[model samples]
Target: MAAGTRSRTGASAAEVATRIREAIFAGELVPNQRLVEADLAEAYGASRGHVRTALGELTVEGLVERIQNRGARVRSVPLEEALEIVEVRAAVEALCAARAAERVTDEQAERLRGIGRRMEDAVREGDQAAYAQGNKDLHGAVIGLADQRTAAATIDRLRAQAVRFQYRLSARPGRSQTSLPEHLAIIEAVCARDPEAAARAMREHLASVARAIAESARD
Candidate 1:
């Protein structure tokens, strides 16, 4: 792992779980690194049982894997997994975009603008991590504006994995700069109440991510 492991601020097992999940998504927990329960427990000030429990949850998400007697480690996401997630992301985003077009209100629009502004600030500060976090808040706002509870919930679930380990590759080059514009496009399309345009823009944006992932794997 090029980046040193993190000791995040969350205290409880559940909070640690979130921290770990975020680390995975941010590529802080690099692929194939052995996850020592003792190390994690100490780092998070959690019990071994708590760390184990957290690992089990991530395993179900396919973000980690357990070896019979060896212990747990961050899973190396296969090429197929990335492609599948990308496809699902496209479909879900398209639906959300369409629904948002129909349901997004003026207040939601203002809220989104605020989120975008914060995201832009993060970018200007050159804080990729903060920028990424802000981007997530913005996306959640967009989908939440659609008011489709089921769709919103499903996208949230999928995002755990979709976002997992993405930042490792995302840190490569130009991702942060490009992402803001892409997000702005999605917001614009939905604001215009053009479902097809929104869907197409979202699809293209996600597809670009897939291309980046593929290129990263080759490198």
Candidate 2:
């Protein structure tokens, strides 16, 4: 009986954590926003213990921060930290793309192209959230082709750290429109099975994002 109760508690915490994560990624919960446990418990129809457990998990993921007397709030990565994160992401993803280009199957190549096409359609429709989700999938597809689980996990964690900026960048006028072509370049290189070009394309894509964010900060 005791073990069964603990198992159910763990499941509830995980479910609450997932819903809160979706809220963050979907822009329903912006960075630095305070998360009161009572409110969250009420909102998620979960117990305060479950809410606290979920927040603790997200804190590990770098999506939330717990402060003295402040409880918890969505984390906001500093601009300098964000720049560093992107640089690391560039190197990591570039290698992944290069490796993937050499090993990707025909079906994976087709899926990459399909994700790019869907992104293009999202851009045209001005569906920023959809485009952002596609962008996430596109990056995952590239990493998936690399067949490195450890690298994939590292990238996923870094992405969660950097995603608030990504959403902020997506809100910049014409940013997504310009980024679509960069995605194409990466897809084109992957499709052609050009490892060097794929690496270069991935690097260029991240560089462009860094530049856009920098430029936006200037304005």
Candidate 3:
């Protein structure tokens, strides 16, 4: 009975952590916002102990921070730090793009092209949320095509932190439209089976996004 109760508590805490992480990614919970244990316990319908466990998990993910005296808050990833992360992600994605170009089938290439089309449509309709999701799908597809599970998992962790910045960038005027061409270039290079070009395109695209994110942070 005690073991069963412990298992249930752990599961509840994990669910609560996932929910909070999704909220952070969706911008419902902005950066640096305070995370009160009592508030979260009430909001998530979990015990205070469960909420603490959830916060501990998020803190490990770099999604939340706990100061010495101040309980906990959403981690405000500084622009410099975020740019550093973006650079690392660009390298990881460049490798994925290169490998994908070498290994991707015609069907997989077409799917990558489809992601570009969806992104274009999202931009035309001014749907930032859809565009953000499309962006994730586009990168995820490339990683999948690369077939490197360990590398993909690393990218996923970095992406979790990057999504908030990407979502914010999507809201900037003309940013989404501007990014469409970059995505198309990446798809074109990969589809053409040009590994070097594909890698370069992916790197350049992420570098541009890093610049945009930094610029937006200044405004």
- Candidate that scores best on TM-score: 3
What is the Å distance of residue 108 in model 2 from its true position? 2.2
* Pairs clashing within candidate 1: 25-165
Q: What are the candidates' C-alpha RMSDs?
A: 6.5, 2.9, 2.8
Pairs of colliding residues, candidate 2: none
* Best of the two (2, 3) by lDDT: 2
Candidate 2's C-alpha runs over 4 A off are 1-11, 121-130
lDDT of each: 0.75, 0.87, 0.86
Query: How accurate locally is residue 96 in candidate 1, as Cα lDDT from 0 to 100?
Result: 82
Candidate 2 C-alpha lDDT tens digits along 1-219: 221133433347777888898888677898899999999988887778888888998999888999999899999898888888899999999999999899988998899999999999999999988898898898988898899898897887787777778777988989888999999999999989999999999999999999988887788
Q: Estimate each model's TM-score.
A: 0.75, 0.85, 0.86
Distance (Å) between predicted and true CA of 151, model 2? 2.2
**Residue 73, candidate 3: C-alpha displacement in angstroms:** 0.7
Candidate 1 overall Cα lDDT vs. reference?
Answer: 0.75
CA displacement after TM-score superposition, residue 53 of candidate 2 (Å): 2.3
lDDT of 3 by residue, 60-176 (tens): 988899988989998888778889999999999999999999998999888999999999998889888898789889888888989999889778667677667877787799887
TM-score, model 3 to reference: 0.86
**Model number with the top lDDT:** 2
Off by over 4 Å in 3: 1-11, 125-127
lDDT of 1 by residue, 1-219 (tens): 112223343355565677788887666777788999899988888666667778887788677899899999888767778778877878888788788877777777777777778778878888887887787786777677677788776665565565543755557777878778888788888777788887887788788778877887788
